[model samples]
Target chain A: MGAEVKQTILNRLIGGIDAMSPRLRLAAKYIVDNQSAFGIDPIRTSADKAGVSANTFVRLADRLGFDGFDDLREPFRVSLLERYDGSAGEAWLDDLSHAGAFAADHARTLRNEMDIVKQSLRLLTPHKAEAAAALLTEARNAYVTATRSSYALAYYFHYVARMSLPHVHLIPRHMGSPVDEMVSVEPSDVLMAITFPPYSADTIDALRLARRSGMKVILLSDSELIAPAIQADLFLKVSVQSHHSFSCYAGAMAVLDSLLHHIVTRGGKAAELRISRYQSLREDFGAYWRAKLPRLRRE
Target chain B: MGAEVKQTILNRLIGGIDAMSPRLRLAAKYIVDNQSAFGIDPIRTSADKAGVSANTFVRLADRLGFDGFDDLREPFRVSLLERYDGSAGEAWLDDLSHAGAFAADHARTLRNEMDIVKQSLRLLTPHKAEAAAALLTEARNAYVTATRSSYALAYYFHYVARMSLPHVHLIPRHMGSPVDEMVSVEPSDVLMAITFPPYSADTIDALRLARRSGMKVILLSDSELIAPAIQADLFLKVSVQSHHSFSCYAGAMAVLDSLLHHIVTRGGKAAELRISRYQSLREDFGAYWRAKLPRLRRE
Candidate 1:
């Protein structure tokens, strides 16, 4: 679900808890009201503060699909962490139940992320994916431009795609007439533009110009409501969740990685031979990387 | 093994094959003598021209540790495709038996890339990664400056890192005296410079100026040989394999991805909180990527 939808669900749940059994509803209210203290305070301490029985809290969790109160505390702890720095995490541990609750919530979030990934894959038409692959494979020249958080996504894709194609260029930032350059983009070439919420004006301008030149365009964005659809040959709408305060990309990165794998797989025999030749050159350079071995340091 | 080791092994294998039985040796000689042309002609056609039996050609593949003749032909096909584009593949289909050999060779290249990634991970000291992370994380302002191909790499890193840590800037190309700006850089701020082989003289000049100001410096490069290490508080060297005539980023992207993962993991609660707040605002403003997803087709 998009961020707006998810937040709306939470808001409704909070509003409707009064319709439940008296004790269960009371526990739910306490949980919601004291969420900011979840990780910092033990459930027993929270129970004491909320004036609710521990069993009632556990029962409320069960009603919410959690095994016990610990599950309910997870989201609360995450919220606390999202609101404060790590230093505040210690303050949250005033009781041990907070950690267990937080872990359970995190586990659930990961499961939701997996579901999103599957849904995303399903929503992507096979023809669109194949078209993207063809564009990447056939481009004599590929230009990738992105700004803000999405720029890394474009840069990573550009770097990998450049290996098998010719004349791949990464457009420079603030360079004169990025759009003018796009106006000359060849018919067979592709311009990949990646942007998320609060899209950079420059990236949008470039995509508009590239499309006007009759070049193919691909977009990776957060919502269909605000995305640039006119220039997009293929558009992928992704909903990202934050672990703390910024939008998450674990899902986006996974999808991008799969796309790269698919491109290489379909490149046929020519790609294989080029890779073989590269292996020879790598050995020739001694490639200073040999000095470091596994289990040495974390990069 | 790097490109050098791969080349050495190839040479050794070819030499050993040349010294074997007369028929085997002749087959090897024909292949070695016409390495470049193998992709241009089918195996049967080439074998007939060499006066060697088709079965003898199959044995040559087996002697080279290939499953069959098709396996052996794959490499040639790949080479031609990468070097000559798709036109060459059209001319090279006569050798149906060489496919199997080439696929295995290609798989080996990915394995080499994995090795490079492993080595890069090991070489990147946790101390440096943390120091670099902390420098950028704590900076009141950060500037990313790079030229040529390295420029995209620098911008990508800056874009992602800037999400949680705001106040980061991407210097517009040729904006003049990036050094002058760095001269005013305080101890709490940082300047990141990226340059790879055939390193740009201008990039070096800027790094030297930045270093003199006692501002934190981070350097990303492909080879330490070409990248000066003196001015950097942290240095990361990544190796990229060449495919066709272009350098591949299997290693560089992997290292960069890993860095982002590590930094976010270490950022703990602060990152999550920042992300949450950012997401909230992102939904409200949608500034990151609004224009890339065009809604209507343009003529």
Candidate 2:
């Protein structure tokens, strides 16, 4: 029910946001971006998180044809109840400010990250991975791309995948934009894009271009409700929740790790031969450091 | 006890490797890396994993002044027992190829990642995070560096840290090696270098330079026994173990998340102010994507 209310609210807000005042638009975007905040925290807390005033919530509710803030929260309340029955780590952590964030408690931090990993793993079930891997293995080429914080995630995936899968490529091969690299892309290719909230324009544009080219896409992101995610051929949901200020990527990396395994499995003997050859090349070229003992080498 | 034995074996191999023949050296290095392979797998399995013959193990042991393969295995067995008693995820996942590898079991992969997260958290401990955080807070500047696969880890840290703490820098700012960046580093600065097995020479050299120039150091790696980690003032151990062929960074990202939280706390009002400003500038400059509904936007 919470998910339903969340989705409904998103649908309405994205449509109505342009008509509202700047402040209302800001609050609406915040609500949409932080999908669970309203369900998890009080209106005041949600407002504070959105960096808007409590009255702004009431006004935004009014604009949405709701009676008041309480009415606005009712759907979320119903959904929150359903959420409590399951969805362990989704809403339990919101601020993490007072106790979890500032506490310097490494154990709590570790637990928070692990919870994210667990939840992300749960969301990205084996079924989804297998489906995604099948798409990847079937594609003639797979291009991965991201910007800013998410670039690291895409880089890691492309780096490791390229070691064995020569067809894998990281986009924006030069310094332009992902769209610049989309020129030669074909329908047989796949685009694996990683992005989170405050999403980049280039990534969305890349997704748009991929859609136009009739290319398959796998989006690794925090939410499936986004337009690109809904349109994606496969969406690997990764929890970006964290104990710190930044959204965590542990779960995203975990998802990629599992996906890579499937690619290897699907690739079979060819993948193994490629991996071994990559290994030997690294060894022969002295890509890795060998143990050096000056004293023993004297002999 | 297992740790002690592992360290002893590492020290012996590093000192004696130069005197061994090529195949013996390969076997020695394989043992040094995949550190627990010997104890966890049988002679045949270990030899296969090492990509060398079983005779290579016996000959390598002979060169190390051990009786034979059994003599080398004894220390590992003792260490293996000790490891089993305490370290939950360490030795158990030596090779995931047979059952875990090819199977498209996302749950097992998730569980594998979570196990790594659990063990990495267990190893990092609250005390270590506090100490590392304190070092990070006290440093006039913190320079984070890594190469290839590990670069993502360093990049994420510096990227997040720079938002609140402007003093943080990602080394090798342009094209030169990390050692080139160490010229201006001072005792007041701290070097946080991330690397794992098949470690990069640039990172190790950066650590060496930091040590020589009186810059404090924090090492984030899969193991604490490495020479660079040993010299580091603080070591935050992260597990790179996984159910896939690649070494997972889920644990490493978790560690960085916790440490970043500590930095935020330690930075206090300044961090809060900087973070808010950074956020607002992004908002004011329209750095983030706002939902656009073309149909609704039609006047």
Q: List the candidate 1 regions with Cα displacement exceeding 4 Å.
A: A1-147, A152-191, A195-299, B1-115, B138-143, B167-174, B186-189, B227-231, B257-271, B285-299
Q: Given candidate 1, what's the lDDT at residue B159? A: 60
Compared with the true structure, the alpha-carbon lDDT of candidate 2 equals 0.70
What is the DockQ score, from 0 to 1, of model 2? 0.12
Q: lDDT of each model, Cα atoms only?
A: 0.54, 0.70
Tens digits of per-residue lDDT, candidate 1, A24-43, equal 55455445433444334566
Q: Give the lDDT of residue A53 in candidate 2.
A: 93
Give the DockQ (2 decimals) of all models: 0.05, 0.12
Clashes of each: 59, 1
Tens digits of lDDT, candidate 1, B54-106: 88878877877789886676665443322211112211221221345543333
- For candidate 2, the docking band is incorrect
Tens-digit lDDT track of model 2 for B1-299: 65686678777776666566655655675676444446545677777665667888988787777878877877765554453333223222232223353342544566677777767766765568788888877789889999887887788888788887788889877577988877788899999999875566777788888988899999999766555334888888888875545587888877787778778867888897887676555434323222221111101
lDDT, model 1, position A187: 72
